[model samples]
Target chain A: MVTETQQRLDETHAAAAPVIEVRELVKVYKGGTRAVDGVSFTVAEGEFFGFLGPNGAGKTTTIRILATLLRPTSGSAKVSGIDVLAHPGEVRREVGFAMQTVAVDPLATGRENLELIGRLRRVPASELQGRIDELLVLMKLTESQKKVVGTYSGGMKRRLDLATALLHRPKVLFLDEPTEGLDPQSRNALWEELESVNRSGTTMFLTTHYMEEADRLCKRIAIVDEGKIVVEGTPAELKRTVGNDVVELQLEADSPNELERQRSGIGRMLEGFEPVAEIKSSPAGVQLYVSDAAAAIPELVRRLDGDGIRIGALTMHQPSLDDVFMRYTGKTIREEQANVHFTGWY
Target chain B: MIGVAYETFLLGRRAFLRWARVPGNWISTLFFPLIQLVLFSQLFKDIIQLPGFKESSYLAYLAPGQIVFAVFLGVSWVGINLLMDYHNGYLDKLRVTPINRISILFGEMVPLFVTCAMMAAVILVTSLALGASLVTGIPGALGILALSGLFGIAWAGTSFVPALITKNEQAAGSLSLLFFPLAFMSTAFVPVERMPGWLQVVNNWNPISYVIEAQRALMSTGFDAGLIGKALLAMAILFIVTQAATIWAFRRLTA
Candidate 1:
């Protein structure tokens, strides 16, 4: 039955139209900056689309535009086939947005807030109560439903926000860094909840700066940077674009810059890989993005040892989305976020 | 529209229920209006000369005026409530819901304006107990109610333009910038007739003044229909203007 359900869903998605579609989306704020500079992507009917980027990478801007909160300066987007600009109300009806912070009213009880949203969405009165009860249980807030939201823990508030967004049973759910600023435990729990939500056939369009989050949740991702989509594909496919594995060499050197220069020279010989994006010194050590770590390691070591930069530490791991991100942007996501804060909007 | 009204009614019930958790807030919603009625009626009695003047009768005439003032103050004071919604993301729940978005404002208005009107009536009845006569009858009484509500529409509308524009609670309360002066410029403490030539000209043109005068005329016997019509018309125009400004602000806010 599980297989049957999965097969039916796959076939249904194959037959059904895209839930979200954006074409040449451009958003220029009141200032002169272009946040989403002619970026575009499509989200299939039931796909969990991760819009991954560093902080300044226009992820939130795109999400806000898609959520119908902000209008694009040019270009267009449609949620569930409804043009966001032309029919924002209709788009709003089809999508549920849980913004970075769960903005639940502290004065009201969790249950009251849910009921209020239910009424706003015009949920049938009889069905509304049952749905609220179901969401309470789903979010594990049944025990605290009657308590004022102000008294809720950060995780609890976030859960309620998610519940409120889901109250109307929207076709597309947009979560903007849903677990951002959350503790590791809370984030993992929320991730599990989101996975279950996906299992229930909700098309989630999630924007996240956390690479692990994108890797864990998104079937495919668009790695956006500097207001443009640098790459788009499944996580595995994008990682293949980098290399099968990433190797980092912690070399004992008097100077970091000298070590960086040494790594670059050793990096040039391993041009056997079709796409050797770049070799950059990662925060941890001198890192190389290569096609095959096993194939390149011995040759890389001989070449580096020939240069007299003794390796203090050597570790090899499968390329993560972070490495894939570094390949495209010449920097890791966290480095980009630290180096710049995004002041523009999509 | 009926759905909107009903939903607001439901929300009002919920918000009012919050008093059970924090019962102290009810004191101001009920008692604050009465205090203004008593304080202003006594303090400004001789200074504010109505069309029909009496030292004792001043309190009676000032009840409806204060009622209108109460609604203005209440709605504007609750600007922080909307800010709290913004901060907590509670408003987003309403934003994403399939229902009419106007219900968000309507729900606020239901308890706020309706309660202001009810409190205004209680003040009016209390003034009667203290020897204030009904210079006008049931129509006039109902007119007072209408005046308080319309003033509320304007106040609620005016407050919304700035409420959501603010980022957090402190900025939201900065709404008092618009509120305090708008209250004072109208007929809350003094009859529009009592203001100096320049200020009188300003007051005559003020939308809030029209609401006060129209409401005052409805509650007093010596009232003229033409002034009442003009006052009501001014309020109607201001109502449309305020609502448009609010919706535009909302549009900007979402943007």
Candidate 2:
């Protein structure tokens, strides 16, 4: 429940200092596959930033480089003001990474998995138990903490993996598709958890192919494709670039010619209206692209009244992030399957 | 250096727990060695009376070989554990930690010492339970476990090198089988005199034979310092060579 003023203050604070900065980072694999090509961005402290893209669009590769898991072929990245190449160990200490694949040990119990990572991250022995207990409860996994992770459900494994990453309370968290394969319910639950984590002042850098995830979680997002960021802005700002809210009118027409006549009649009536940007015909009735559909709906109804064009249903909706993606990339994202690439030392 | 040791201890404990929690790991490792120890001892009971046999029974001579065999079996697929981590992105998880990278490798290696020794102990206890004598008794049994543990640590490089080089689970697994001839050609199944002329010549240089001979002395012939020294030297040489190659492979994979 962030108030408008509080969010504005937080944004102001974030803009005052940058926690992560990348300058033309590039990663070219052995066979000349340029995974990340000249990507550059800076994340303000406390900002929730995301790279929204289809898979193989370099989101994972860029996040991996920032997390100090992979080396770049050219350019530079810094986390918490530490150069990733020059001082990766220092960068590692300040950040936590939850990979796309769940990395928990199936044989180890949930508690053991957290304990191992906590110890490796140098969480003090005195505080480790308390932290694990807190996280287990937070993740709603207290009852199953002693059970081996192999017995946990997929959502439970994901929660446990996230718990391990949060163990050390890193300053910056890098999540690569944190909820990629989750059911809708689990995905929503994890989204709430992530929002709470970001609200606690941890700078978040996330990469995902889910448009809804980016719209819901990221304060700012970069739409990436073909190893380049095609567009970057807040979700609302990006969506606004796609132009105008849509108001579709379902009409009561007995014949196709009557429907066409009614459609042209509505179009001719709304043509001179200041708020309506454009009017187009549809199979059922007419569609209006309006600057503010809610404000323009009354005027629209008045114009259509007594024209023998009866309206059965009216629906108004804002342009969605997918529309924004399609506006830039010229293809819908829903049909694209994730192209998962293994950049291991093969 | 101290940081590496600490990290290794912590991660090694996890690796050991991962092995111990799974019943299949120990069951599979001990199955072949136990079958050979029980069946072969009875099947070739009269082979001991041929010419060069000194033990009172074939089981006595067969116990030490089974102990070494258990060590071999315990380490054969140890590298696949690391490869699993690599495939599952657990390796990347560990890499992002602030600890030294070598700790990950050492962590996997250190636990083999305990598991190999424990597996060897099971065979030793079973052999004694079946009426095989331990001349030097409990102290001898402890010595045998120590040797097995050390030998297990040294021999694990065979599995690790292929795993890291190929980065393929099947290749790593099959390549470990290529070392089975080393185990079979050693003195595990026969004394040097009972072997063919060419095999006996091969036995003189076989590191597994040195370890088996030392364990055999502890089991029946009493403590032989010369035999123990030769076994230690052999393990040291093998450890240096295999581990060198293993380190190189690990570096290349991780680099």
lDDT of all predictions, in order shown? 0.76, 0.90
Q: State which candidate has the highest TM-score.
A: 2
Off by over 4 Å in 2: A1-17, A246-316
- In candidate 1, position B75 carries an lDDT of 64
Write the residue-wise lDDT of candidate 1 on B1-255 in tens digits: 887787677767765555345645545655766787787778876653456343346776676567676666666656566556655656655665555666666666566656656656766677677666666777778777766766666667666766766655666667655567867877766665667788888876787777776666666554568767877788788878878877776656544
Docking class of 1: medium
Q: Could you tell me the interface RMSD of model 2?
A: 0.6
How well does candidate 2 match the true structure in TM-score terms?
Answer: 0.88
Give residue B74's lDDT in candidate 1 (0 to 100): 60
lDDT of 2 by residue, B183-242 (tens): 999988878888999999899899999999999999899999999999999999999999
lDDT of 2 by residue, A92-175 (tens): 899989889999999988998999999999999999999999989889999999998999999999999999999999899999
lDDT by residue for model 1 over A1-346, one digit each (tens)? 9999999998987567588889999887776777789898999978999989988678888888888767788998988988988998888878889998667767788998898777767888989999999999999999999998889999999999899889888888999999988999999999999998888899999999999999999998999997899999999899888765777777777787776766665566555644344567776567766566677677666665565667789988988998888888778888777754544222
Q: What is the lDDT of residue A97 in candidate 1?
A: 91
Candidate 1 TM-score, true structure as reference: 0.79
Which residue pairs show backbone clashes in model 2?
none
Q: Give fnat for candidates 1, 2 and onward, in order.
A: 0.71, 0.95
Candidate 1 residue pairs that clash: A103-B88, A103-B89, A103-B90, A104-B88, A120-B99, A121-B98
